[model samples]
Target chain A: MARRGSYAKGVAKREEILDAALEVIAREGFRKTSVREIATAANLSQTGLLHHFASKNELFTEILRRRDEVDAVNASTDPEARFIDTFPMIIRHNSKVPGLVQLYVSLATEAPDPEHPAHKFFTERFEGFREELVAEIQEGQRSGEFNTRLNPELAANSLLALADGLQTQWLLTPTLDMAAHIEAAIESWRSDPKP
Target chain B: MARRGSYAKGVAKREEILDAALEVIAREGFRKTSVREIATAANLSQTGLLHHFASKNELFTEILRRRDEVDAVNASTDPEARFIDTFPMIIRHNSKVPGLVQLYVSLATEAPDPEHPAHKFFTERFEGFREELVAEIQEGQRSGEFNTRLNPELAANSLLALADGLQTQWLLTPTLDMAAHIEAAIESWRSDPKP
Candidate 1:
């Protein structure tokens, strides 16, 4: 019973540290933020933080993993929900968490190099996300929810790009009202004929 | 006569160094690629490279500036061309230069911070680009080339986002057909009713 209690405490501490790290990274960006600063923010000694996360890279990777997990959960809530239908909601949720979005954009841009630590993660993320989106679009077309004239693969890529691009613009210009723009794009996708 | 020849040689050397720096940055990212590597790749001594570029940041800024200049020239060829009409061609051109595209994406992601060296450049670039796009859209509407019902600002922002997002995805997956996807999005914008 004592072991279980301690394990639960450890999990709580880890979550606290991740929260602090997210704030620091969001405020200071990944390149400028340091592990020591994250440690201090979490009210833990650097050694204590190290105990939970072996290195800054490990901590950063964990944060990304957790974000992906959350996104996966949100995306899967309705097994019957088409992925395209949920994108605007996801973008709306993302607007509420600017720091996570910043981290994603910054790291994703940096991770294109084959040697970057997050390279494989981002590559696989895009490939998997693209595939899932393509399948969803195909399903929508079959069900007549989406225009059959549009190429599913191309439409899927455009939707993903629009979401990412809007997040970036919103980050740069916070007053941009990202959700509305995304909704507009989605609306167009649903109604427009092939060009 | 000797001084004139030396000045011409210097100009040639500067272009050569920029080319090498672009190659190095494209191969490794901005963070990992060093001034020393750039100097070596340019076949110049570190001192020689410094004589042209005071630091890596300066060199990077210059590279970005040059790319922008090229983009501006390409985007402005037909004075009467609607800005949105040229996007597909620009994207087609971008596909031929993955290195520059990668550099732009990586740096633009990092430049969101007010303190980042490229922060002003990116902010101004987006603002200026967005304004130009808005103007172009307005012109298109007046000329009946674009849907008059669309908000020029929203439509312009969406188009820019689509371009940036497509570039990021293209960098991640070189096989993606970026120009075609962008064209489709633009087509939708021109025909779809507001949702």
Candidate 2:
């Protein structure tokens, strides 16, 4: 068994490497950026970096997984709080972590190939996000806060799509107010209810 | 002035290269894809292809620019039709030309950097699309086909965002009914203008 001290150091080094990888990827892009560049950003030797992540894909894949950790920090656990209050921080954090945002965008587009590791990442990401939104919208309907006419499944998909789309615009403009846009969508949605 | 024979040949060659490029890119991604690969697919050579394109970027840029050709084609001849007709075909084409879809996905996300050549290409693309959508919504309102309370700009942006997001999902899951989802979005806008 690994010593507790060494385990803590390993975890710290992994996170440090992830932070550096995220920044390098955001600025240089995947094609242009090299593993050595990422190592430099993390203040480690190229060989040292490889010791942690066997390849660029492994590092990139880990970065994507870490992004969920970022997502989880702001993610509400109660599941009852309105989505309104829930995700503003996610937007705020996203702006600050443009690298993560850029990586998300880059991988999402390129990862569609069945062979790409991130192909499954984004695939699962959307599925989980869609299911959550559907459940939440359904819950809202039962609680009298949402429109019964709203097809939760359809609306959920649309909402998820809009979120992905907004990420592109936000990455470009950086000032378009993503969460505000999402709130506007919710407003648009709530305006019409089935009776 | 350029000779008529050369110009015609160049135009035809450009189209041929695009067709071949699309097929090759579907099987191999942008980076793995090469001028040689495209040339081989077109039954030409490195020099022959270069004679027509000058460079791959130039050729691909035109291809990317042509993204709106279908929408433009329909718009000029039949400007009075509802968005539903166009939105579905657009999504369907995304399904058919999945590689080009992948190409657009990768390029659009990365092009946000000012250094990227396609940056201005998409900036103009979004601006033009937004303008067209706003005008359409306004026309619908003036004709009493849409509600007055609707903000055409916001709705256009939302719909555009939703389309992008939904495409990401559709890419991951081959079974998704993208057109139906887009159709539902159109209905939401038409059902209640105030919402």
Candidate 3:
């Protein structure tokens, strides 16, 4: 009974740390946010924080996981809407969280190395995201909303790549309207209006 | 004079080092290639190579510059082609050198930091590239080769973003047909043929 109580406390503490980390990262850019700062914000020593996560990489990965959960919850609240419909909103939300976006771009570029600690996390994330996008695109095609000529897999990949690419650009040029560009690109893929 | 002769020799030596670095990076990929290995391939000590470049960032930046020169020479061999028309070919050539592509992606992501040595280089490169694309796109619009409704600036940005995004995906999944996707994307922008 004591062990179970301790386990629940540990889980609660972990959530507290993640929430603190997210607040710090969102307030300060990723490059400026340090683990020590996050730990301090969470009312833990650096070592105590490390005790919860295996390493900095694992901690950041979990932060991203937590972020995904938050985004999914926000996106899914509209039960009638599909993933594609909410993509632009997600991007807009991302624009408001540049720090997290920076973390994502940096880690994604690094995670291509098979031995990187976040490698498995990113690999599975990309695969799952692509699968979800493909399924959504195929549905759009069946409904004659998207051009049937478009390959669902390729479209999914392109959309994901475009979003990633736009984020990179947005980082450099903050005023770039990423969501608008995404909307325009999606419009290009829509089936041509009847003559 | 002797001084002039030595200056000429120094310039030649710099070219030789860049060529060697390019060869090494093309074969080994950006992550696996090291400065020492590049120095060895150029038949120079690391210090000797550093004499020609202010730092590793400058050296890699020069390598990219050299690559752009080489690509431009290839891309412009046929004077009739505009930049937009030749873009898919450039993407195809990029696919052949995954190492350089990886280097480009890594450096681009890093260069967003204002303090990064390559920041100015990328800023200018993006601006120049965008201007060239916009000019070519405007020319196509005038020729009725592209839809007049599409904003040239947005289209240029979209194309650049798509290419950058596709490169990111290609790094993760090697079998992706980036050029084919690019071709299809360009096709989508073409003006509808009169019935």
Q: Which model scores highest in TM-score?
A: 3
Per-residue lDDT of candidate 2, residues B93-154 (tens digit): 67765666666776777677787767778778778777888988998788877767678888
Interface CA RMSD of each prediction in angstroms: 1.3, 1.2, 1.1
Model 3 C-alpha lDDT per residue in residues B1-195, reported as the tens digit of each score: 367588888889888999998898899888846678889989999998999988888888888888888898887688777777788999999999999998888877877798877788777887898999888888889999999988888888888888988888788777989998788778878998898
| Model 1 TM | 0.80
Candidate 3: regions farther than 4 A off: A32-34, B32-34
TM-scores, each model vs. reference: 0.80, 0.86, 0.92
Candidate 1's docking class is medium
- Candidate 2 wrongly placed segments (more than 4 Å): A2-9, A22-31, A74-84, A191-195, B2-4, B23-32, B70-84, B193-195
Tell me how far the alpha carbon of residue B69 in candidate 1 is from the true structure, in angstroms, after superposition: 1.8
What is the C-alpha lDDT profile of model 1 across A63-93, one tens digit per residue? 7877777676876688777666777777787
lDDT of 3 at B27: 90
Q: For candidate 3, report its TM-score.
A: 0.92
lDDT of residue A16 for candidate 2: 86
What is the C-alpha local distance difference test score of each model?
Answer: 0.76, 0.73, 0.85
Residue B150 lDDT, candidate 2, scale 0-100: 79
